[model samples]
Target: MSKDRLISLDVFRGLTILFMTIVNNPGSWSTVYPPLLHSEWHGCTPTDLVFPFFIFIMGVAISFAMPTKSYDNTTFNKIVTRSLRMICLGIFFNFFGKIQLFGLEGIPLVIGRLLITAIVGYALMGNFNAKLKTYLAVSIFIIYLILAYSGIKSYEIVRLPGVLQRIGIVYFIASLLYLKTNQRTQLLVAVGILFGYWALLTLVPAPGFEITNLEKGTNLAAWVDSVLLKGHMWEVTKTWDPEGILSTIPAIAEGIIGVLIGQLLNNAKLIRSQKATQMLIAGIILIVLGQIWNIIFPINKALWTSSYVLYTTGLATLTLSVLYYCIDIADYKKGTKLFLIWGVNPMIVFFLSEIIPQAMVMISFPNPKIATGQINLLDYLYVAGVQPFFSNPMNASLVFALLYVSIWSVMLAYFYKKKMYFKV
Candidate 1:
């Protein structure tokens, strides 16, 4: 481990990414374990913590990244550029296979498009001339727009709000707050946002609804999404989006909480043990407060409720505190490398996790056992290769998910060995 870096943070991030990959890519979604699946309506599940954890981790990263720097045009540009790239990547993932090009729309088209975009994206991220990078960005945007509205598919209905998009926006806002405001101000803003969001949801009625409620589609957050994002909302529930506009207020608070924790962690005046102790105490307090608030607001992940933010941030803080004590403070270094590899280069691994499965599902081959006389590559691998050995469907699905994660782990290990970390 490097003297400059926190082994525990890397491990925590890697663990989150690993679990996120497994949660997202089950062999069969129908057979997933209850803990792996998100809660149906209100309440927190293990799966619900993954995203907020990542966001929290991002804030921690910002604390380490920005404190050494003097805020100037260059710093501002870097922040904006990184955030925009992440949001663009999120948009690209949402609309990956929707655009048709040269009479191609499946696996081949996806591969080609991904390759071209990767090249352009790489160039934009490279140490290229400012004018050239801007030109490349504009060119890609124009091409993407042309393809989106070319009438091949109804681009109007493509979902806009997504996980990465939310991350990007929150990161931008939180980064600015961290740069400009004092620690006291940051904490105050986080508290105000949380309480303000709670009040807005519980007190004010949505435009179309007469009552203030936390019901699925009738809630203020969902209603705001329905009006603002109309055709661009999530497909599963057109009337609402899990990553909606209003809900993001609480998400920002979540990020600010992360920033505050990061500030605590970054404080050199405090020793590792002190930091760990403080984090544990803070985590417990937040968790208790979240539960108390949940009595009225409810800890709903879909809504990104204020209570949900407090609860998950509490859990994250507790987890990190333990990791810090064991790994960083005590110097117990055994078995830390497994997660370190995945943690170091999370953005690329996550992006690959999304596109690889899509490409796999698009490629089909003959399979006599199926009604269609063919099956996609992913299903065939799961059905023929893994399912036959296990008696239980859920076990088989889980094994397949593990297998998928294991394959990526191997790839990430190689990347780690080569020191080839790709940042967004």
Candidate 2:
């Protein structure tokens, strides 16, 4: 099988990339869809589902794209080379994507840490005894305790858990799992992890773990986060470390779901009509399961609760099915050029936006408001230009979001025409 139908995967990926652009870059933070706002702590939101869905879908793509257990040395080398390139790109995106080198101390330390991390990761990424990997993971947790409570207050960058790091770690383990375990066992692990997190939060008492608020520094997750990672890192949530240790469990599930998705898509034996029906039914089941789980567990983006995973996975599947139906079955792909562009180079678009915000922000001019001389540029723009036109902040934010996507959409359109796919 070719393992790729550009329309379905790109459309689905494009959908995700579009939301990423929209959610990340609204005209004003104050305005957004109700679904867009992350549930404070114990609940779920549409916005919360976005990142996991994206990563999960990435996993799906990986399954389709990656070679199976059998491979020649040349092919293996190619896989290694590509994986290495991706790891580097992901790290670069982590370090320089959103940061500016201000002075001597930060730059040198950043370089020093990257060197150390590379050495450590290089040493770390070989065939270890299975139990040893488990032990190392456990030991890493213990060391995290020592660092957090050891009272050696130092802001070393690598000490923190970040989006790329979490992805790296989780994906590494996930690859091993895929190699070593059966589907049933992997599913059980995911279940255990989610419940384990729940038990920790509910049973293990922090000073005020029971109380859920936006103050990430004190929450149960934050306590673990503060203990495990101590630097600036927020990929999942703005207030909390988006890729917190507690949340990685569900994130892995996202990848596993992708495995299933890939299985469905890759099994070319199934007729297109059969695949569409199966996907639709599977998506519906997930949505139902997510809703039911929400009653007890609460679908939370920050938490990456199992229910949220199920719900988002379902929605993602359904969305993919629809795209497949339209583009392939119905043969109707009139205006998907823009999204296809962004879709092909989603990671590049993301990292470029993060790194090149200076040039990218020209799409919308900043309108600074003098609120007793304390002005916020982002909010001011929304108030002056967006708010006057749209009554609600959500509408204004949505408009800005559309424009933001449109800017990238246009760039992608040109990239699409030029056949420019900036792959990592």
Candidate 3:
């Protein structure tokens, strides 16, 4: 490993990406295994931890990726540009295959925008003129706004923000915090956000609903989403989204925890064994505290409760500790290449994973097995090739999801061989 690069960190990130891809691309959502599916509400599950874990990992990355110089105009501009590109790319992914121009449909405008944004953001490698880079990034954001506006079907306005958009927003906030604050202040700020969010949820009644309960579409968060987002919430739940406004406050805490972990790892005074022990001890304390807190606050992923943050952050800390011990401290580097591949180009792989599935779902084909009507390509393939082998639909569904992950792993491995580490 390079002096700056941590092998364990890469492996952890890669494994997180791997599982995220699997849970997201399950063959049949309806038949998914309990562990892979998010809890209905007010509870944490394996799947519930994935999104926060990614955010936490990003936070850890900030310690490594953040500019070393004093914050200045150039640094601010770079931060804004990178954040804009991420959010714009997110908007593009959400509208992929749905863009229409001059009454023409399926233009792949989203993908095109993504490519342009990637080029401006990553391929140039900060080599281009700063003003030009800013202009290109701003222009991409404008085009995304126009396309997103055009794609909206409802006249009610207010639109659903994409998952990537939410992640970008939290990322921007967390990164700014990192740039501005010392470790002590960062920890205080993170803790404040979590508790402050909890207080607001517990004390303030939902507008018109006149209750402070955490029920779906009835809580303060959902009410905020309904009024602010209007027609823009998740399609499945038009009234509210899991990644809505209020929940993200606590999400920032996850990122802060990651930053702390990164700092811990970077502390040269501490030996490798000491670092692992410290992390493990901290994790245990947080887990216990979270469980106790859950009695009142409740560990809910959808809500992104303070208790949930504590629990997930605790788990993530422990996870990184184990990986660090095995990979970095023990010098046992066997069989980590698979994860390294995805880790090096995480967003690229994740973006493709998301968009490719949507594209597959959009292309319709005649399903001979269906007797008469047409089915989308994904369903057609599932029916003909995957669904018949097992009596349990869930098992077959899981198999299909694993296959999707395996395919991506192979593609990423090839990219790894070529050393194509696409980043922004």
Candidate 4:
């Protein structure tokens, strides 16, 4: 096995997470710029690529993190443990600020704060234990389930599919494929999955929906989401979710592609130049293939269409290739420090980015516009600190997002300095 430390992987993962934080935490969703927001329905946008890029990064990171030649109980336990942690975290996030009962908003906020405090206390004590972790995980799930199901009559609360949960699922599948098969077989499997998903979505007529229709809720993916997930879809659209079950088939293909690329980069026989050239060639080929397929399938992030997978994965590959050349091959390391901080504590920063905003939103302050009403701390911070300065709402929103990312970066730097890294 190659002992080469791929600094580019960390930089790339950090870059993707940084963008994800920016896109997810804009000052005001209504005022966000065009490029920062996802596309209305079809076609690709910069924002749409962030999630898939992170998943691709996970696949690449797996190649480095996991044992390649062996499959055993230890490996299986590791996979299950990491995946459950992620899924539990996802459930916590999904219910963080959303679960309120009888119009009492403070209940969920209190629960969220208590959860954060417990985790912080545990970290400070440095007494992490498997039994304690198991109990905590089970307790969190039970609490979330109660809160989620409790408000079903008056609210739309249900067991929603979360970003972390989806990542955990996809990560497990991708990791297993990497462990069980060689790179060539993985590549073939990826192509076969994409082709199969394309056929399933395009050729088969969705029950009670239009034939070959790929519209918002009319597609087969959406139908499956509705039937299987029922009230557990995205809050924005109860009928369908962007990270629904069926769409994950093609999403797994993206991870497989990442694993294949990671394996190629891991080859000790290849020189840095050869590795970079191969990735560049592969990226170009995939992009061309994606574009050609887009004509027939229509690239849609919500659907996680085969074309969308190919195009986004291609872009991720090209991006990684550039970073690999500059950072690993050329030894240009100075500029990657900020990304490195974020990369090292990606999960920690991401969880904080989400939980902080949600917590802040729960604590209300005087609304400047409405004499009788109030706004959350997050909204107040954006309006008072950033929104008032710029005439353009979009500019203000973008600046707020940048400021949010910077705040997290500062916190992450402290952790980096302390050599405190949080994984999974």
Best by TM-score: 1
lDDT of each: 0.85, 0.63, 0.79, 0.81
N/CA/C clash count, model 4: 0
Candidate 4: which stretches are off by over 4 Å? Answer: 1-4, 98-156
lDDT of 3 by residue, 1-424 (tens): 3467888888889999999998998888889999999998989889988888888888888878763626778888877876776676666665555444445333254355445545544532344577776776688777655645665662224344766676777778878888888889999998899889989989999988666888888889998888877766777889888888888889988888888888888877999999999999988887888898899999998888999999998998889889999999998989998888888778777667877787678667677866798888888778778999999999999999999888988988888888767654
Minimum summed lDDT over a 10-residue window in model 3 is located at 151-160
Residues forming the 10-long window of minimal summed lDDT in candidate 4: 120-129
lDDT of 4 by residue, 181-232 (tens): 9888998999899999999999987898557788998889998998988887
Q: What is the Cα-based TM-score of model 3? A: 0.91
Q: TM-score for every candidate vs. truth?
A: 0.95, 0.72, 0.91, 0.91
Residue 190 lDDT (model 4): 93
Q: How close is candidate 4 to the true structure, as a TM-score?
A: 0.91
The residue pairs found clashing in candidate 1 are: none
Q: Which one is best on lDDT?
A: 1
Q: Which ten residues in a row have the lowest lDDT in candidate 2?
A: 358-367
Instruction: At residue 135, give the lDDT of candidate 4.
Output: 56
